[model samples]
Target: MIIASEKKRVFIYKDTQLSDPSINLSKEAVLNFYANTYPELNNATIDGPEIKDTELHYKFLSTLGTKG
Candidate 1:
């Protein structure tokens, strides 16, 4: 019988899906790594680990919003 090694992880930023991080890293670590590329993530919050098709999905919700 075959067993899955690790669950796939995907990070959503600005409507863009980013999936290129080591599975060893924790959810917070993954966010910090991408913070360099997307400074906006600094003030962002982690959304969910919503499971879909055996894949782990995470979304970086930006704290910055327009004041109308």
Candidate 2:
């Protein structure tokens, strides 16, 4: 999974199981699973200083989660 903050980034990878509760329903789980499947997202360049803020970060991630 790719997890980033203003000062750091993280990458994780694993085989995802469709039966896993994390994969079965949660959008957060889906995003995390995709990130885990593709760790290169850890290298993505986030645009704007606003995106670097922790609150905005979660808000943006949550938007993706809720939207899909």
Best by TM-score: 1
What lDDT score belongs to each candidate, Candidate 1 first? 0.87, 0.33
Model 2 error, position 13 (Å): 16
Off by over 4 Å in 1: 1-5, 65-68
Tell me how many clashing residue pairs each candidate has: 0, 1
Relative to the true structure, candidate 1 reaches a TM of 0.80
Summarize candidate 2's per-residue lDDT along 1-68 as a digit string, tens digits. Answer: 99864432221223322223232434344345555645553333322223342322221121222333
Segments of candidate 2 deviating more than 4 angstroms: 1-23, 40-68
Worst 10-residue lDDT window for candidate 1 reads 3-12
Candidate 1 residue 1 Cα shift, in angstroms, is 7.9
Superposed on all Cα atoms, the candidates' RMSDs to the truth, in angstroms, are: 2.9, 14.2
Model 1: colliding residue pairs: none
**Residue 9 alpha-carbon offset, candidate 1, angstroms:** 1.0
- Candidate 2 achieves a global lDDT of 0.33
